[model samples]
Target: MKHERGLLIVLSGPSGVGKGTVRKALFECKDTTLQYSISMTTRSPREGEVNGVDYFFTTKEDFKQRIAENKFLEWAEYVGNYYGTPIEYVEKTLQEGKDILLEIEVQGALQVKKAFPEGIFIFLAPPSLKELQNRIETRGTETEDLIRNRMNAAKEELDMMDAYDYVVENDKVDSACDRVNAIITSEHLKRERVSNYYKRMLEAE
Candidate 1:
């Protein structure tokens, strides 16, 4: 059998666009063995979040220190908090012949693609900006100022959607998950990959 190719699945979306839910569903696929790239954040976990799993909770000072040390793959600031993807985990997983899923913002996704040129980028967009605004407002925990700030930021991020490899519309949870999962599964069976495998096997025979 030929060696399998690894995938770098970089996912991006505006705030409250259902990225997490879509990613969660992808993990449930039978043959899907992609690992999630746990990001480091200075923001505190709300509730029931495990340290080092859900996120690598850290101090602002420590986060800055990581930046100084050049440890982060990609980092970005939002709503007065800093978030970064850990480069080591990404490298290790791909080295092991496993795919990785990175959930980050659009700007950070651009940074990641520059670092790993072969990575696949998928952008999940809401049905509409109005729906995105409703999702934020319906959350009910944020102050008016915070909600307004995020909505404005989402508008800016939406403009960057054209840079992605695949654009998925998150109008419904199940439908959106299916679209994202299909994109990944379809990539695994590309003609060049299959042709390369046959070439290797015939040479060995």
Candidate 2:
């Protein structure tokens, strides 16, 4: 059977929500193609982070210039640093009929929704606030203030979950990825391309 070309998957979650892990799992499926949008940031890349792969690190002036030119689909400042999705690359990827993934925060997700009305968004959530707090503490270097701030942010993001098309609980990697995979499959089946293909297959009857 012929399937739709690919998917535009937008994934959002707060810090320590294990979105990265789930994203990795989702990318492992053989039939699916996944690409993360490289968000430009004013913040410097940390140790071992690649220049373009992890993020497109740029200076404040360059970021501002892009903003002035309206080159970004969406942009936001966080903790004294700015981050944004470059419009040119995103449009190019979508134009190619390939799957595109954006693993961004809730704020960015909302901005994406405004630009791409048909975009599919999924929210990854921890089972509970306590589980979320515990997951954050597992890193073992958080200060009291940091922990509290992260917890508060999680609550804020969770409150906006309804805005997403699907919400998957990150209780288990396999199960979570399975749910996401199912969603992508179902969406592909819903496309008009699939119906057309089915019609062709039935012509012999």
Candidate 3:
């Protein structure tokens, strides 16, 4: 039997939009099957973080070398650190008929869209700009200047929302997860996907 290539689901949003929190919740569900694509970063790992699991931490020199070699499907430098998705791992997993989920920043996601236009792009949005600002302020890890800068950058990111295939507001994590799962399910059941399988089967017969 021929294995069908799996879906590439990209989830992105502005900074401080709880992308990590939402992704963690989504994967914890008993029915979730999407394989999380661990990204590579040039930043220092936080306490208790595991290499090749939370993120594939690497040196800036090595990361730049990989970028020069076109090893990444998409990459972007942010806050003096580089983050990217390794193309080889994603391609191999999809070839094995396993769905891959990429939770990344807006800039990285846009790069992925250009390289993999067929991939499903989901924009995770906050309920409102005020609420987004509140979320950032609530973090308390960033300085006032940094928060202001992030808010400005977020406005720009929100402008790019039209580029995504679907928009799910993060009013509540559970609701957002439900919408994302539903979108993936519908994509799998789309006529375009199923019809290709049926065509190949008939040709084989």
Q: Best TM-score goes to which candidate? A: 1
| Candidate 3 structure, TM-score to reference | 0.92
115-180, model 1: which lDDT tens digit per residue?
988888999999999999898888777789999899999999999988889999999988988887
Is 1 or 2 the stronger prediction by TM-score?
1
Alpha-carbon RMSD of each model: 1.6, 2.9, 1.9
**Model 3 regions lying over 4 Å from their true place:** 1-3, 46-49, 203-205
Lowest lDDT 10-residue stretch of candidate 3: 1-10
Q: Choose the strongest candidate by lDDT.
A: 3
lDDT of 3 by residue, 149-172 (tens): 889989999999999999999999
Question: 194, model 2: CA deviation in Å?
Answer: 3.5
Candidate 1 global lDDT: 0.87
Query: For residue 61, what is the lDDT in candidate 3?
Result: 98
lDDT of each: 0.87, 0.82, 0.91
Total clashing pairs for each candidate: 0, 0, 0
Candidate 2 versus truth, CA RMSD in Å, comes to 2.9
Error of 3 at 49 (Å): 4.2
Please state the error at residue 46 of candidate 3 in Å. 4.5
